[model samples]
Target: MTTAPVQKSSYDRYPTVPLPAGESVITGAAAWHRVRDLAYERAEDRPPLIVVDTYPGVDLPELTRQLAEAWPTAVIIDVEQEAAKPIEEIDARIADNLTDDRVFGVMSHLRLNAFYDQERLAALAERLADRTAATVLIGWGAALTATRPDALVLVDLARWEIQQRQRAGAPNWRSANGAEDNLRKYKRGFFVEWRVADRHKRDLFAKIDFLLDGNAIGHSSGVVRGPGMITGDAFRGALAAAVNAPLRVVPFFDPGVWGGHWMQDKLGLDTETPNYAWCFDCVPEENSLLLSDGDHAVEIPALDLVLTQPRGLLGAKTYARFGAEFPIRFDFLDTVGGGNLSLQVHPLTDYITDTFGMHYTQDESYYLLDADEDAVVYLGLKSGIDPDAMIADLRAAQQADHPFDTEKYVNAFPARKHDHFSIPAGTVHCSGANSMVLEISATPFIFTFKLWDWGRVGLDGVPRPVHVDHGAANIQWDRDTEWVTEHLLQGPEELSRDGDVIEERTGLHELEFIEVRRHWFENHADHDTDGTVNVLNLVEGDEVEVISPTGAFAPLRIHYAETFIIPAAVGPYRIRRTENSQSTRFATVKAYVRGTTRTDQEGPALAAGNKGVRS
Candidate 1:
């Protein structure tokens, strides 16, 4: 099939979401009155519940007082005060309650979900109802047992904002040692604890009446209608409008031992932290969507969109393949000016499910973005390398506290910008220093088994733990240097050329559920999701605009290194090139689920060239 030219229509302009500044929406005492007015039309029998759920250490006493003044007959009830046990007692209980080997990540302190007793809160809500006056329950999980509040306001702070607040030495209920322990656990892995805590809060989305922007809390804040208050019919209509429009998720960053300055310096991220290691560009599990209604912005977990509109976001085929789960994930791994990452491998599909209570495995690939002239990526094993010998060496190094020559066993390939390396489950891989890699993979993250860490200690001055036995069991012994070069080591191949645009395909291994392609164009390119969700990354060029064919969406402008997703509901959409002084040719990486039927676009699909599976 030949390519077509870019179509011009009335909606051929850049898409913009008008989000008013936080100060304009909510600032001081005047702003408090405006926030109180959100529940003005409601009856007195069911009082407005403005649950100011702030991050730890963020005291909302002043806001609470203002809320009381706005409703003279309303009584403020702090959930923290209603706790059945003291903070110290809860801490001890949590320490003694551990019986499993579950991991802890960023939300470490909440692993036990030990803050308050749910039964107590439910009973408290009942007793408070006996009073003749209106009741305003304010605190985290306050609305969990609330009796149909007129309003439920959620004050959420970004991850970075929480980090900054903690670094500023704000007073938290936890002790200094407890805080330090949580931080250490976060660096180890944030998914285990975070997911558990978040699963309970999923229903909170349906309960939220208003969302308060806490990005600049104490200075400025913004409040908008929440997704929970919208009816199903209304949400469906809004979802349709959003699908045709370009959507961007609120990306989050975390630091690691092998973090680099590439994202910190190039992306102009927060340098106050150690360094930027991983950027969750489009991972719905940990990312949130910033939706604006022309006046205010509300933040909702990206999973909410997937859960509510799976077919609309993920195409029918993709939704069937992975129901209510965003299968693809785009993230950045920056090791520039830092040390090499740990030599690791993920478990196979069946292994992961049997071991960890997860249904899917984390099959991933590395797309080199920025690299030093001599940068190398360690992958697979050297020819004639013995698996038993390597396992013994790893164990010996761990016991002796000594570093071994890892280069002697593993093969290293020259890493250049735009190089694609397929790393299916059981393949040993690690991005070396001085390279920034974009990791496109399955959404089941945080299951890496680190075999070696170069004998280095973590930022906490303690040696990071390694799982040599786990890695040894999962490593594919047959994947040697020759296998790596013949299968994983390859570049994007030109598939079809049409005018100034050319479609180049890469990472087409059978082991991977998703396929990647790069579109090189000077002006614009046409693409169809084809019953699947398409994730786009502007790897090259300054900025580009994504426009819908039927003028259903507002034109969205995406800059270099930024990632965005086009829902399957969009169907056929055009990616129009925008003017940029930096470069002329715009190169974007498009990823989507591999169709059941395959065909030759311009040539044959690039094959992994591997024969054995689970051998």
Candidate 2:
């Protein structure tokens, strides 16, 4: 319950893109002045109409109070109170998606417009038809109240910040559940609120006159403060620059029941917290991006880049396959000097699609960054295990006096530094204590069905959710010790070598869509995105520089344990050791979507197998 103490760290947690020399962000009172000036410029004969559309979790009362102070004479309408449906009605509509389960829910297909009453919307529009004085409309769906506003301002918030607010007792949009559990709150946001808001947000990116940083407010002791505003041109330019070069999202660390001290020591995180369990470095859905002009920066959701530049950031092949979604995810899991992770299995593809509305399932791999001598990874199942008996034992473990004998049913493999273990869907797996892992996998990350938690509770003093019935239906009984040893225990195979640079193919299992490659170099290494986005991490060195061959982008310096992205449009680039790096040899692990076919010059096929469906 204590706040995490701030500490100086070498990790570049707040990565930013410098704006052009002549352009700078406007903040505080100046931001409101600029908005007023833009509104006057957009005015024709009558007074202008300004619409401030907001994402959920924005400080509406504070923003409105400020707007009232700035424009005392303007008529301000609260869009939700005027046009949105009642809280009870809205809850009923989304009840199916926001299921009773605390941690899981079906993905919603509803749009923002569905939350509003059409008759009320018409009435609100009628009132603003002949306004003499300036008028202002604001709320989550404010833009829906007017057809063509003279001035449109978008207020955006990152999902991670939203989670922080929820944990601090903020309710979901238009709901009165501030006292609810954090898991249920997160489930509602993940399944229903965020989906509808994103659908509405994507349609406004092309037309907004200005973008406001909702995350910048109320930062009493941070490097940046709120009310930051940027011209639409600057906003679009920043996103364009990110797609053409290497970039990183702001990383966030959280404490867990099985958390460890590795991140605290390595990443320079807060030592006051009990432990750091996870670091979300590349999950765009819950990360923020900073756009700066050297002197000042504005923080916005990283999802904005994906929504605005889907084709450029994700590449044509990836965008077409996933439809504006970033399919790959990279995160850190620390269990060193702590407890083991929960025994879990991901639902098969067919099961996920049928039950959760997800097109793809989570197929993941753990790349050990560092490990203690006693580190181990539980994978697959012990050979010749009885399926029915295993399920019964797992069910019985839920009782107060029983503990599931994990070693009796699962195969434990020795874990070491740089070891890669492939985990296809339906395979049971968990990392044991004393291991620092860099997990790379598909982005459907919340689908894990925990079968056991080593008889432990969460940091909140609550028992974690267990999905034994779900796991029972999806476990691949055939994936026993022998099958796992043959297919899942991956050893690096040398793919090519040139002088000091060596490339090796690491396994993610042929059944999985992601392809991983490790590169080691003393001088420099060449890489091509090959029409797909590449996510890489400096797994072995202190620092390295990423540069484009054609001078397409400015050089980007990456530090140890940092994850950076190279968009597909980058074409050809090179990574070389920085002058400050102490290590003679450097290493990086890169991941991308696997192509359906291979060329003769690319080498023998490393991944070739059909993903099976659940029976």
Candidate 3:
């Protein structure tokens, strides 16, 4: 007899798994209790399993002491106070959680370490499964399976707790970014939406709803998560490994097909499709759908979290989990099926501060998601054409191509799949025609500098304004134009890498909130975290799965060529491969890396690989 297909993506089997819905936040203390309690409830008796982390933080012991007063006693094992944060600690946490070969178990407050692995949570699940064989497992935060894998009980406490606490002491925009005058407009909170049904609180469907814009799913979200908080976990075990331990992933996002509208022919440019679905705009429930907003996304860095260190390469995170002063947002885009993007420019940190009296950090880059072998992008100006020449022509109502001095202009050549040129602040650039790009940038939400818009109109069907004058002044004239064109003019190096299935151009420029790189995976790499969860992104991959510490993995097929974040705060994880067939390249951005220079020093050169690469 033929059997019916099994239903997936739900937790009906594990009725007790408390998954929150919508905007409500959940904290770590509540998360720990949920897991520990579930572990006990699922116990089958042999010397009940006792789970723990590498170095439970200050609050964990207090929580445990509180838990013990009301629950059963268990063994305590400390990995070491100073263990390397993400890598070493995660492995150890898993080993200590399992019961003896034959014993039933109740793991309490297990914390795992986290890292920047693209597939953080997947690794967490696998490790957890390996160590313990409990019938049901309890988990909290990001990256755990919906169902209990062993004696583990998990609840996604990250989103809820994060947004819940993000509103502490926000910036006095008046003084923070120097945008004193523009400070009049402030978002109460990025993801706070109206018309939300409160009863839909624990529904994953509900959460995803927040991230979609009816038709498309991207619209740039923003918020400041603040200095002390971090995303609860990356690898599943990592959360259990570093409970109360500090960690952070500057908030960023993954985009998907959603709402967007582009008016074709209006700009006098060719059109592939009149209406593009640049989905990463203003949607909601971005965490579940795994969608991200574009360069416009506002992510806050956590203060206590471990980040790449030049020591202070980025500003502290101030949004969810530890909620901060500004509004936080999450969104993404739809490249192939995405909507039209402008060929424009952004002001440098200085200009945004000087001219506009604001801080509009340089969140720029040249992203080529797809190429037809003949695609060319106008990056910079012709070698000798005066800046005023272009400006004067535009002001005199000259056609764009005329005064552009095509000879002085350098063509960004051989556009290939996944080729990215870093364009730091004060650079003149665009996303080029055809390719859809995932633009992960900084947190200030104002667009001051602009260039010719090719004469297109906004979604409302009116002509969009062009800022040629501001553009001229904003483009960094001192940058070596040749160096940028040579490396980014496009060729084989921009197409493939050793053993890489994905080809990409990265290391363009650096910023306080984000780090962009390009890579291709020949075979999926195993990235498990100790406990904190990570946002696993697939800029071009088709499928991936994150294995938890216990070996239970969550599989995803990213056919849309979008990015996804993986959160595995309780354990380790691994990303399974989708293809070994050939090359696929994509950019990897580390959000909120920390600002290299402060108000005190001259801004150091953008990290590397970015800035003024385009004309």
Q: CA shift at 151, candidate 3, in angstroms? A: 35
Give the alpha carbon lDDT tens digit for every residue of 541-596 in model 3: 44444345464433433322333433323234544455532335333322223332
Off by over 4 Å in 3: 1-274, 281-341, 354-360, 398-412, 443-448, 486-505, 510-513, 528-536, 549-560, 566-572, 578-615
* Ranking 1 against 2 by TM-score, winner: 2
Question: Per-residue CA lDDT of candidate 2, range 20-137, in tens?
Answer: 5577999777887788778888786778899999999898888888888877888888999899999899999999998888888999999998999999998899888878888999
- Of the pair 1 and 3, which is ahead by TM-score? 1
lDDT by candidate, in order shown:
0.66, 0.87, 0.34
TM-score of each: 0.80, 0.96, 0.45
How should the candidates be ordered by lDDT, best one leading? 2, 1, 3
Could you give me the TM-score of model 3 versus the true structure? Answer: 0.45
Q: Pick the candidate with the highest lDDT.
A: 2
Candidate 1 residue lDDT tens string, 81-102 = 7843565775565552232333
RMSD of 1: 7.6
